[model samples]
Target: MTAPIFPLSAVVGMDDLRLALVLNAVSPAIGGVLVRGEKGTAKSTAVRALAAVLPAVEVVSGCRFSCDPADIDPDCPDGPHDFAGPRESRPARLVELPVGASEDRLVGALDIERALAEGVKAYEPGLLAAAHRGLLYVDEVNLLGDHLVDLLLDAAALGMSYVEREGVSIRHRSRFLLVGTMNPEEGELRPQLLDRFGLTVEVAAPREVDARAEVVRRRLSFDADPTSFAAGFSAAESELASRILTARELLAQVALPDAVLRQIASVCASFEVDGLRADIVIARTAVAHTAWEGRSVVDGDDVRMAARLALPHRRRRNPFDAPGLDEEQLDNALDDHSNDDDPHDDGPGGAPAPQDSPAPADSSSPTDSGSAPERPMPAPGESFAAPTDTFRTRRLEVPGVGSGAAGRRSRAKTDVGRVTGSSRPTGKAGRLHLVSTMIAAAPQQKARGRTSAGLILRRQDLRLARREGRESNLVLFVVDASGSMAARSRMGAVKGAVLSLLLDAYQRRDKVGLVTFRGDSAELALPPTSSVDTAAARLTVLRTGGRTPLAAGLLRAREVLRVERLRDPRRRALMVVVTDGRATRRGGGDLEDAYRTAALLAAEGTAAVVVDCESGPVRLGLAGKLAMALGGPAVRLEELAADTLAASVRTFTGAA
Candidate 1:
């Protein structure tokens, strides 16, 4: 493998993101940080860099689970008694969950040979087992299959997986830090899964020209000499690792005062955030911030810093709402609660601050004393102060779309059909057919047929049938290879998602096509071909930069379908458009014309699914409108994974 490049010290401009990583490093209980950003936003680079700086954890030698021999609990099967000698130790592991991994490969399965040969049930370990006490990173997490995601969440929450398959009843501890990265353009992760994340930070491409240039320069240098480049940053990497270790040690002593608790609650209330997630995350993050700063006590500044990372994704009343704790409103609330002589006050250190003393400007104030100040007391009637705003805007209900019930029903139906077909074999069974056996036996009997021995089919003669469904699916991927997409890092994510989908299609023996539109033209890079490798190779070479010519791309895709339709009507055809919905050109005109053209093409017998790849606060624009016009689904790009593609294919074709 290539040596890891891009040390953690090289990351710049994303202080909030870095803080989230630091917090998670200090306390894994704080949960994983969700970094939402466009494509070129250094999200993966930062993550890899952080991984390099992480302290190497000691794990059991020869154990795929990376079990801590010293920390082994009663549930551990391979206890000290089972080992021949003292267990060995090794460095921490960073395991990547590839998109195409199977269920058996992920959660483990029965040892088939052991079961069949010796009639002994033996358990085999999987990726989860291998990732124990390490980092289990999943890129494009939102697009992961719902089943796989559920399994991951269950394992992460319970810290174990119980396997009760093939007469084996095995429960193994499989605890690991779940680090997931996604580009929001593909699709959104389910809310239940999203809640599991402790901190969320939105990453954007380098805004300054100098930063972008520097990124390119560094990347090129590393590519030219991976070993030397990594060696150059060794000192910086060591320093980061040391800092993280210090933070982890300091996390336990970081104290949260009642004042900070009140601030956290007030901020959540001000934002009208639903549930207790915001409050909980804010508190944990605050503690982590204090620990990171080498402080023994959490202060107002710690709470303030935590708010930025914890509050954004938690206040989900409006999914599209801008993130952060509403700094202006939060500052005002703090000012209002800063009064002295309040009986309810408990500022930093638990005890009441002197009523006559001025408030500290920073968390580290009273430096000469070398100790945190006493918690302040709340004034009379101040403890029960009502919020200025009782209610903010309710969560936006996208018209005509039922929130949970309808969606669940649709998804359930889709899953049922997909599972049934996926489980069935496509070719002939190995044994003799039942009908053939009956016919062969009939010929051996006399004309009377009943005079002979009663007809009996032996187990050796029994044959199981296989169900074969329509083989090919015409999948046309309409990619928005526009400049804006390239700027936000959406292009890389889109490419990844497309590659994942193509891999799925290839496995299913489906045909796929690639059509990318940018600048003044749309190009059909690859026709509908069963060779997914060829299509994927062409896709990887696709660079994003130009105006969006969505109309032309759709028209070309439609024409390709027109030809394919003549060959087979049973074969499913789908047009997947990946874009941020910003259809514009270099001539300084709105993309309204292109949008209309796309809509018209989509209406012409093409089953369409639009993936909004845009990130940040930008409006989704014409994508949603066009999806509606096409009478198809509009999903965020981050949500577009292998399962999503399969579900879309089934939905559009009404196929089993």
Candidate 2:
């Protein structure tokens, strides 16, 4: 027997999540709920419980699409056929979306047999069709592929799927409650997709000992005897189901007061929400909450609850920003709209409105002894002759097929590469290569008795096309932070330049690593990462002092780049060495050693750029010579402003 799902009521804590799910059920017009939390947080448990409590839906008999009898479309074949067929009521289901599901599986495909034998296109509905009028649950939603997420969004937004494949053009209703559960630690959902979810609830593991113990006890009891444990909650489940039915019935009667509407708008505005979706979601949720409570008119409490569900995920502007609403600000906004007659209508419990506290005056004055004296600004640094068109990215070639994942270069079709997939797959093999399939099936076409019409093919004769993708760049910054460079504040200038390059790296989807050389040798400051925050943090506390180990730094960078290349051969490697080429170590042969190491890097196909930080009347131009040895360009320290430096590197690297 299948294991019984934990009852919704049995879920410990996480009142917000329960309410959000309930609100969506009562008013699916509220879209769907997204539960974000770690494992053992009852996220999945609550989602599955929703299926148990959901009332039966009337669907057309024998309709694989689960066609709703009441929503018959005249143009749809199911309309006339299902209308004459028997209609039956079945309990609404929670359809789990598999992670590896393909686009054809999610959306429907052409009937293979009908097309192959009769040469007639017949539509075969997919999982989305079965999910109609039900809850489509996706676990670990953050880990889902980008293409699948886009499809989900489109289906949810349109409430239908329009398929035009294999000479078949059909549209079918695909309305479903899209409930997704994900752990934040695993990965983050795209911002665009996150906003599509009407309600976003964050759950946490039970903190209190009593609650934790209760959860463990209940889980153990259920595991020990699921039948008996589920039997105990049967009556409660029935009552909850009845309650949900009543809430659905009352949903049409739920009213939204003008004040509540205004409050929703105000709260969303205060939070700087991206679009009006939050406002609409909040309003619908408030209506749902009022209906769930068996109330006709919506109140401040309903609005507050709605805001809690709808605004959290939308408030996030950056990747690291936590998903949550500004409660204090929301309360203040709601309080401002409270009725003049009702003075205590601040929130649910007649609490007073939150007010911003006055800012404290500055304690220190310019004349204070404790405060340091301000100095006059120095004159601007001399500007260099910057190239008009300096920024361009090189399109590097590699020996591999592309998976279309981010950071992989998209290129034209080529025969010499790994067999990735066809540019377009729309035949017997699903993604069968048309040219190859036709040629393979040519011999069998005459015996198949379809020669008079045209060339015919069998499934076995199909062949898939392959994609050839180029390599992406990986720029590694090797900075000279020795005592000499630090004394001249060259490190500061280099830091700014590196930051600029990092920004460029982010845009181009290039990977970056930082290696700062000081003291006895060089150390990896920051490992290769796409995160700008990580790079910034590592660079912030980088200290500089001691003799310059130019040769060691070169060797260290070469090893790092070599290892990285081996790990991801699809990445074109580049090293930007920031130094004056002055090797002031005790041995005094470090310059030659560094030049030899640079030549090894060049031989390894690693691009290089040496930024000369030397400042004197008679410059040795050792950095320029080092650049030549590395087979890359040499840039002067004077041309080391963020933009100029970035542009010079881009130009040298041939990056557009």
What is the C-alpha local distance difference test score of each model? 0.63, 0.71
Per-model TM-score on C-alpha atoms? 0.58, 0.75
Q: Give the per-residue lDDT digits (tens) of candidate 1, residues 61-176.
A: 66556667667645654544343435775555677887656556678776655543443556778888877777778887765655566688888778898766435576788876
Using TM-score, give the best candidate's number: 2
By lDDT, the best candidate is: 2
Give candidates' CA RMSD values in order: 16.4, 8.3
